[model samples]
Target chain A: MIAEGRIVIDLSRNGDVRLTSNRGADVARLLVGRDPREALDLLPRLFSLCGHAHVAAARVAVQEDVTEAEAHADTSRVLAETAREHLLRILTGWRVEGAGFELPSPPVMGLVKNMQAAVGDPAEERQVSALLAGYLETHVFGISPAAFLKLRDLAEFTNWLDGGPTLAKAYLCQIVAHGWQGLGAVSTQFLPALSGAQLQALMAEPSFTLRPEWHGQPHETGPLARQSRHPVVAALLELHGAGLMSRLVARLVDLAKIPTQMTTGESPVRGQPGVGVVETARGRLVHAARQEHGQLKDYQILAPTEWNFHPEGVAVQALAGLHAVTGRAEGAQALIEAIDPCVAFEVRAA
Target chain B: MCLAIPAEVVAITDDKQTATVSLEGVRKDISLALLTDVEPGDFVLIHVGYALNKISPDEAARTLALMAELEEVSS
Candidate 1:
């Protein structure tokens, strides 16, 4: 809700990336004494970007009586939110790329209801799916998602992107134009799922969320990490080595399969201060809470931004060696946007 | 973790840590873990899942008096 701080990529002389961040989640500190149910209801309002995901995670973490139907709905909500998030990025990027498109709002709202329906039942799925596919084809990739997904290599991706002035293609073209292709390279090291005990234990230390670590090493936890196993993402990794292009491609890979993914994946079930690890738009979102008499004794959340933006973390590894990069601050911003922080940030070349 | 706002404690569980707080017209259950000797009428800053601080009546009245004086001076 506020401009937390700035990530200054110093290309002027040092060419170093410095994120002078002033973000603090005092909200969680306040929740220390609140009832678990109150905490659960408030989670959605707290995180505007992924309210459903947050509430779902909180509900699970508190061991609330979540029905099977509710779990499925929550899973679909994550998928829908992710899809909209990707589309919004593409939409905004296209505008920046000088594309004369006029899709003021994404049609994702229509699909939201269906997204909450029972997975695989196909509740209004056909209509919503077609609309989304058409919009992506018409406004984003300039090719069918199926066609984009079928792309086997970088060459194929380039050819498909070369077809028209859609959002992603235009941005990809800009990346190619600026020759910022291989910049912001980071290898994916995903944070494995933690049990309730493990998560609570890890979170016991202060500054754990501020500087999150996975097995004592900083790791990446976003679309790139989630879709690392996909073939196109693998191809991008092979070609670009998890650089800006690979990370961006991984996002598109996520975008491509959203229709199918939204209607299929099931959330994991756990009871007693349960830990729900949902792959939100940003990355791995962990919600952990312990309850006493159905009241929250303790609660904690580890958002993807913490993992990606740690002081000695993925951003440092990904954003190095760009001092001599020509696009300067704008280029730095593109790279940072590729990583996508959950909170507000200001990026400048120092 | 979240944006905290002041809410009035409407109800409390027997444990004294858990309570319901009303914000505007909406009432939600929240934790009172950060403050002690809280009652149904007390105001607290609600966040992620807990109350960060309790707003005392003395502080509120002092702030109100300061604002009133500032308004009179401006007038």
Candidate 2:
């Protein structure tokens, strides 16, 4: 296994969200000057949480495409991994805070099989939907998928939080209990859709693959960015901005969309200058490769963590001027986890 | 793709999604959101915050021994 990367965050008396990591260096070492095939093979080994999405991004980055069946398979696999990642975060978050929760993995592989069957037959498709609805109701939202999907405003979301038995409600309660409402506030600086030329310019830096920037400013990628288009997300944006709660809720809610994406998402293939923009469970991931003479001439990967946790980026911006309702130490840790670095992190109060 | 370790579930919550797990007095909350069947006292392989699989005590010991051996070789 690729050793999990480390992040060191320092919360100073002045309330600075000072964060640092060497994960980019690890990625650069693995990718730069390496064969595309080897790097693609290593993607899953390195990124265990959402390996399928990493693989898909690499395939897209290499100007590769899969048939419709393969594309559906890839999407379904990634969706399964994403749901697992979200559940893990929730389970881990609750437990670390002293919740006595059990550990039981969802039937990820089985869901993929069922989703495949659903792709061809309506009956199996309904079965898949009903199955997901049951699981999400019991674990995620405490409401039917239809009701959860019907929530289009903060009022509805608030009602759901007030009475819903879902993990989303529990997570919201945690944030509010910690007095983190409007805490760790980040601007909605979505990474703009890029042209091939722009992508080339962004990837020109030696550190681009691990820590990409647009116009020299850091942005966010991941569930929050991907689901910013949803009605509930839009309401949250208007009401709460992108805080810790908003980010976490967006993550859980994204589970509702994965099945649909699997059945209707675009082909996971692109041609030339292969710049693949994929949304992993954590955030947006980009993999681009340039091939010449039947060999990889250049390759780069941009992970969501790189953008959100950048030294002077979203994490710092969110933590700036944090009031620290609890203690600086606890508040800082909460804020960091709110930004949710894909890798493990260490917190220090100085 | 990753490694998980055997842990004992000491307590379970009302929601059944979170539980307290222990490994030698150290405790953690493991998410049960993924599995259809699990309970406190179950021994499971833990990774991140999710319980990966159930294991027998003997099997857990054997896996740990192999892991320790691999660490030694790597070192």
What TM-scores do the predictions have?
0.75, 0.75
Q: Write the per-residue lDDT of candidate 2 for residues A1-350, one digit (tens) a residue.
A: 22335788877777666787845224424454557776676565344455677777776676354466555556666665676667666665643344443434445425544665566564665567567667767777788765777798877878888994455576677777777666766675987667666766677678776567788788777777877877878777777788766776677677776545444553332323467666667777777777776567676767788888888788877777564545756666776766677777787776
List, residue by residue over A1-350, the lDDT tens digit for candidate 1. 22223344344466566655555434454345678777766565444456676777777777457777677667767777778767655554433455555553526433455555534566665456666778777776778888888887767777887886765777777887777677876665877656667777777667786788867898888788878877778877877787888888889888888766644554433434466667777887777666677566666677778888887777766666576667666766777778887655566555
In candidate 1, stretches whose alpha carbon ends up further than 4 angstroms from where it belongs are A1-12, A94-98, A109-122, A193-197, A266-272, B1-75
TM-score of structure candidate 2:
0.75
- In model 2, how large is the Cα lDDT of residue A278? 65
Interface DockQ of candidate 1: 0.04
For each candidate in turn, give its C-alpha RMSD to the true structure in angstroms: 12.2, 6.2
Q: lDDT tens string, model 2, B3-58?
A: 33467888988978788998656898877665546677777766557666666777
Worst-scoring 10-residue span by lDDT in model 2 chain A: A263-272
